[model samples]
Target: MDISGAGALVTGAASGIGAAVARRLAAEGAHVVVADMQEEKGRELAAEIGGVFVRVDVTETDQIGEAVAEATRTAPLRAVVNSAGIGGAQRTIGRDGTLGSAHDLAAFSRIIAINLIGTFDVVRQAATAMSTNEPDANGQRGAIVNMASVAAFDGQIGQAAYSASKGGVVGMTLPVARDLSASGIRLNTVAPGLIDTPIYGEGREAEEFKAQLGSHVLFPKRLGLPEELASVVLEFLRNDYLNAETVRVDGGIRMPPR
Candidate 1:
């Protein structure tokens, strides 16, 4: 689990929690790969952190392979953070209850493809590469951290697609970790509550909206910061004893179904 002088890949590193995780890994002396779809921002962050940026769409196998290959070129790939995902909110049936009131099948499928299947693809490739790495004293070759959401547990109304996708991520953590155990690769998931990120638009109105959302937190009365989540991610990677666990970074908030 010693990532120093090794390489790390972080998907969705263009911004938000993924960006924070990428920077943290770089600061820890890992050759980080900023894998993301946003070329400009990904490149910018890569340059800022003295890492490489690979334009990757997790759903595409070729693109993910390229990113993993790039990460391991200079150093052994020891850390991977699967943070690339999208959000979709649609009920099985709209209030109208008309013929077309059902949730859009394509939208639901897209979320699953990206959040669930995409995550597994990256993990599989990353593990394959890590399996070739020389193990440490504890026979640990690498560590993986996957991003989930509190919605996976406390899904609200209209969050069918988003919740299902994240739920799948959480559901697979233990089994995937078991499968990777022999290779000395560990897998864990972080289920985050509301974290302040670019997904929320910038402006005074946006601040007000976020505040209303934060009011629900049990303490501190604010949304979590991306860095806060990033810190936990590092722990998961560095703590060799941690595996097959889903830790919630929420501030003691159990979301209410709206």
Candidate 2:
């Protein structure tokens, strides 16, 4: 799919990898819709990139639908990047082996809701909008890129909820691609490792954590940048043949059990 001059929606575009992807896509000439819950940051980024900001909470179906509508309102809906997600750390059982202190079901459900179901909802709605678009020369209407985590495959301790949520994303790739193939839309996923993002905190604490995590990385022995992840996302969106795939942008690091 040719991303230039198309309507692209990126969820969680307020910061981190999503923000980076939005900037890159805009640079590629796509009219980006920065959809995020952070009004101030989302609006700022959108303005910086000459794009529009749509305040959207991916878990809210109505908000996502509205966002999709706004994104496609002025141009053909061609690309969607599902980057909105939350992270949590909780063991299945507590140290005292008490059910009351174990992982909270509500927290687990929230993670799944935001990371897994929310991604699916965005894809479903975006694909629907893209289906109405006239197909390009390659019979492609649009492309979708979803965010997962290395935790999905190599989850450490205290990551049950996060891992399960991201695992759902990885599991859905093939089936979703097949389902959307007939509609001329493609689906894929990106599983990032320990990237240098705000989620890891700031200053000395973040540096220390990065060092510890970097030790596990096979080469370069350092954290990845958001731009690196965004580059992979661009590849997934540009390459028409790369469908139903989940690429890990982890710098060859398979997380160890904690």
Of the candidates shown, which would achieve the greatest lDDT relative to the real structure? 1
Error of 2 at 243 (Å): 0.5
Q: For each candidate, how many residue pairs have backbone atoms clashing (under 3 Å)?
A: 0, 0
How well does candidate 1 match the true structure in TM-score terms? 0.99
lDDT for 113 (candidate 2): 93
Clash pairs detected, candidate 2: none
Candidate 2's clash total is 0
- Model 2 C-alpha lDDT per residue in residues 99-212, reported as the tens digit of each score: 999999999999999999999999999999999999999999999999999999999999999999999999999999999999999999999998888888889988998898
Candidate 2, residue 248: lDDT? 94
Q: Could you tell me which 10 consecutive residues in candidate 2 have the lowest summed lDDT?
A: 88-97
Best by TM-score: 1
Model 1 lDDT tens row, 14-128: 9999999999999999999999999999999999999999999999999999999999999999999999999978888878878598899999999999999999999999999
Error of 2 at 219 (Å): 0.9
